[model samples]
Target: MASNRIRKSALPGFRFSIGFTILYLSLIVLIPLAGLVVKTAGLTFPQFWETVTSQRVLASYRVSLLTALFAALVNVVFGLVVAWVLVRYRFPGKKIIDGLVDIPFALPTAVAGIALTSIYAPNGWIGRLLDPLGIKVSYTPLGITVALIFIGVPFVVRTVQPVLQELEAEMEESAALLGAYRWRTFRKVLLPELVPPLITGFALAFARGIGEYGSVVFISGNMPLKTEITPLLIITKLEQYEYSQATAIALVLLIISFALLLLINTLQRWTNRRLRSA
Candidate 1:
């Protein structure tokens, strides 16, 4: 005979919750994206293509993508090191250093831009020291990468820190006892666990660097085809009241960013599945 009792769902009201979630996401995310697409649709294909492919606009894309990529890569390396240091050792001012990592998140981006510009300007303190070597940090592409790196560092450190914390030191010791070198222990043991979170951090930092505006604006010096970023180009178009052109450029950025993020997420998922199987 069939059991008399009915099986209850582990999550009661899951249907209602899922419906609300979809509705919320639609209102907040889908609607805005739809509006962006609709606004761009006002342009003919030729107009849209021309707006996004202009020499100045194309230059901005290159500068933005290249600097953002460099910054994110730098952050991934340095951030991981910082996270490891914080988790694996205690030093004087450790707490202070940890607190400092979040400064970019709390500080106003405009303020960050101004402060970075001041410090890196040719006449400024550090700038004066570096000027003799002919390395210019302010008013150049290097400055833009520096600004992006400053803002992106926290993403990597924060993402990796918790994961590093969860990993026990005994694992490394066990590996050492088994005749593994430090590099071998890290590669054979710790790295697999860290890969997912590192990718997450890289994605976050890369995305932020791509879309960054305020902190980069002042430091970039807004020179067309050199240090100018895509966000700044968007603002310039808006100020000129070229709404259709602005939307077209924005749509291109959106599409590219979405594609890159989708690829990264796919990689993350594959890595996770492999790790689980291992």
Candidate 2:
């Protein structure tokens, strides 16, 4: 029966595709991650614990996690607004603005880092205006967060835009006719439909932020125990020939990131189920 089912499959090159997919994932994803695990295995339990828990490493972890969370949160709110405007409104330069939303997707990360730093470097245009008011961006954690926000906005906007476009206008109109206020209608009606995709966008942005490096390093200034991020720390360790420690830190980040993403997925599933029930 199973053989017949396999033979009856219609997808082109099903077996070949499956085999190639697994092989490709192993070569591209599994192998490198396994290498990090294997390298970290060289450390004793105490050594591994000490390496990840060192004050400097801990500070980097805190900075990376917090900045990523803040950036992702910011993206959720503004990305939703941008997606809504792009989908529901027609105005001058709309196409141009929509295209600009994807700048982060196509522009090189180093170029993005340089552009962000140049504009926020205290001597630069916007930075100079804020500089006299005692606001500084470059070489600080706030600067890192700004860079992250810049890179992550596209993830949320792009993810949610399609979902919003597919949602029926009638549903919203019905809610209004039934006496639901705009705010309540959005909260109770549109929001339920959006929750799943929004969560997915949040998770993607968060994941990107956690792994971000080039842009962050330029703005963060890579100060130890201050604005350094985990990825930057990993690079610094690699530069100093501390492969074991680098891998150990990478493993921690991998585990934590996976765990958080899993949590978000769970929340999304639960929200979907509740929405269906309602």
**Candidate number of the best TM-score:** 2
User: In model 1, what lDDT does residue 117 have?
Assistant: 97
The positional error of residue 229 in candidate 2, measured at the CA in angstroms, is 0.7
Tell me each candidate's TM-score.
0.86, 0.90
Cα lDDT tens digits, model 2, 1-278, are: 99888877855787898999999999999998898888889899999999999999999999999999999999999999999999999999999999999998898899989999999999998899989999999998889999999989898898789778777889999999999999999999899888777888898899989999878878888899999999999989999999889999999999988987897778667755654665
Error of 2 at 14 (Å): 4.1
Predicted candidate 1, C-alpha RMSD:
3.4
The digit string of per-residue lDDT tens for model 1 on 169-193 reads 8888999999999999999999988
- Compute the lDDT of residue 15 as modeled in candidate 1: 84
Clash counts for the predictions, in order: 0, 0
lDDT of each: 0.91, 0.90
Clashing pairs in model 1, backbone N/Cα/C closer than 3 A: none
Worst 10 residues of 2 by lDDT: 269-278
